[model samples]
Target: MTERLLAFLILCLVAGAPFGAALMWTGNLILDFVFFYPLFMSGLWTFGGLYYWLHWERFWPWSPDAPPPTLKGTPWISILIPCHNEAEHGADTVLSALNQRYPHVEVIAIDDGSTDDTGAMLDRLADTHARLRVIHLARNQGKAMALRMGALAARSEYLVCIDGDAILHRDAAVYLAAPLVDHPRVGAVTGNPRVRTRSTLIGRVQVGEFSSIVGLIKRTQRVYGQVFTVSGVVAAFRRGALDRVGYWSLDMVTEDIDISWKLQRDHWSIFFEPRALCWILMPETLRGLWKQRLRWAQGGAEVFLKNLPGIRAWRHRRLWPMALEYCVSTIWAFALALSMALWTTGLFVALPGHIQVETLMPPAFTGMALAAACLLQFCISVFIDHRYEHGLFRALYWVIWYPLAYWLIGLLTTLYGFPRVMLRRHRARARWNSPDRGIKAPTS
Candidate 1:
């Protein structure tokens, strides 16, 4: 472990020195990092997003009503919906899974000791619907355990998992399962999740976020031949692959990210299926959004720390890009915190007038360039994703305010989460914490 830490330290210095020197040379270390780093990453992901769209997504038939992919034989699939306190959306979610256009499929709804009517609703649905099965856990096992229970009871080799609040598109199963069925080595296929709650400004901004940021990232990552993580809200897995990886880790805060890394480490391929659309909700308030993002950031940090040692193997070379990018991003988060600290200190202690603090401030030209890059990135993402989501352009107004907000949230979350993960010693069993699911609107 000490050797590994030393090696990681060396790697960071080797990779970060040139950039650090460049920032120091400019005498605007904080401003350059705060402004230029994201701009640089923005350009990278934009290029990748464009390449993915032009070379891949554009050629595919992506009409909302397009037919399911033709397969030699239809395999029986088990759709697992794990719930805690999801009574409000449980029934709708189950029905959406059961309503899939795929012929041979069953729905397994696991009520993970919900304190609400979610379990009863699932039981009622199972009693009436032959295809629906309900599992009642006596205690609140986390989502990973709930899924593990469902997978154990699943009757099919193919498994599709969705959160209890998601409404699966009728043809979603067909798209999600196609890659697993066709490619013998393909182990998992993650679907695209469209934001369903749009009544509030935060909710509406998330709509563009899912498309412009999340969707674009997935597409770009696919182009890179490995994805950082799968969409946990909606994804399909080959039962064999799940078994090979020992299923989801009980201690993993983000099972989806951990499983993605595990599968890839074990030589299993994961695909991103944009056509497999699932309508989901997001946090509609600042407090709720902060809690949600902080958890996500912590989960990501946990996964990174767990996987870095294993990543040294030659066989895991394919995962290098993701690992490197994650490492850099974590460092960037720390850099932002350091910059803020220096700026605060500068305010109290007299510093030379020439030594300007650059936390939130940047030169006009630099700021304009960064803004333009962000706009371009958003435009490209919306253009590529508008086909999958209608009225996407209308959300541009909301999204215009997204980049700055997103950066702040990301910066703060990582700053908090990275240290928490490092200082934390106990690995407790992961538990569920429900977030604000935002107000619901008509599905139509």
Candidate 2:
């Protein structure tokens, strides 16, 4: 661990020094890109969201009242909830799955070596709900392994896996499976994820984060005929598709990303199912939030390297844009870092009023323009999910926290994760730690 830490530090310094010096040279150009990039991303998302929402039937053909069309036998789906130390909310998760309105469904709840009472909760629930199956591991392997165990035991052709803490929408399984059953080539479907814990300002910010950024990007990725990955929170996959892609990777820090890349590279189609919603709790503290984002970013970098060689093949042409998008995002992250450093240095060593902070920010209207973009994106997102108006519309007074918190968090995680991922080419360890489950109904 010590050696790896040293190597990561060396990599960061070696990379940061040259970029820092260059930013001091071309200061103005970098600032323009920083301001303009948000607008560009917002535009892409706006177009993508409108296109996907307007053309909803392109993915989900079955109406809300209609059941999914199945052939021959009963169309069954196994809902896998992989948990570790989630006993606090394990029952809630299982109850949500058990409450799924889909007629033919089972909940496979795995208690992954939790030191808490997670296993007992599952057992008691299993005894009550005939559709619930419990698997208790003696020791905590990682989430990927736990999911694999549940998948292997599932009897259905269609499988949906969500985090142990996620509360599934009453009809999530039906919506998630519509595309898969309707379109034979569709391998996996990701649902629209909403924030559950709004007890603190941090949780409220994540509500907008999901709707404004995460939600928009998934829609846009769908418009392009490929999404980087399925949402781990509530994604459904066909067993045949899982077999083709060799199932989820046990060694990946982010199995969700690894599986996404594998499926896309193999020519399997992935879709976003907005009607299939899952409400999840998020970290309400900065420490927890930073760790969560860092882990996610690290997973992206790892998946990028793992699939870098495929770019040379002619069949992998569709995947090139995804790779380019991540790379550009990394560049944007570094550019933001550079802009900040230059601004900081100017604060100390400016030539008597010559250098100003605006020198690093856009010349005019960028702030107002960016704020407008955020509001516009939020409004569009909430329109698709009107039930959550209080999370976005009513919270607009506090929405300003989203950009300030997200920008800093995004930049730092990209910087930190990129270096660690780069240095980890030789040796990378996969360890999973559960985040704060946040307020879980105040425990009676």
Best by TM-score: 1
lDDT by residue (tens digit), candidate 1, 15-60: 3553464355543765676678888888888898899888877898
| Alpha carbon deviation, residue 32, candidate 2 (Å) | 0.9
Query: In order, what lDDT does every prediction score?
Result: 0.85, 0.78
Which window of ten consecutive residues has the lowest lDDT sum in model 1?
14-23
Q: Kindly give the stretch of ten consecutive residues in candidate 2 with the minimal lDDT sum.
A: 351-360
lDDT of 2: 0.78
| Per-residue C-alpha lDDT of model 2 across residues 219-316, encoded as one tens digit per residue | 88988877988898889998898899899888788999999999888899998887787888788887888888898998988888678766659899
Where in model 1 is the C-alpha error above 4 Å? 1-27, 351-360
Q: Estimated TM-score per prediction?
A: 0.93, 0.88
Predicted candidate 1, C-alpha RMSD: 2.8
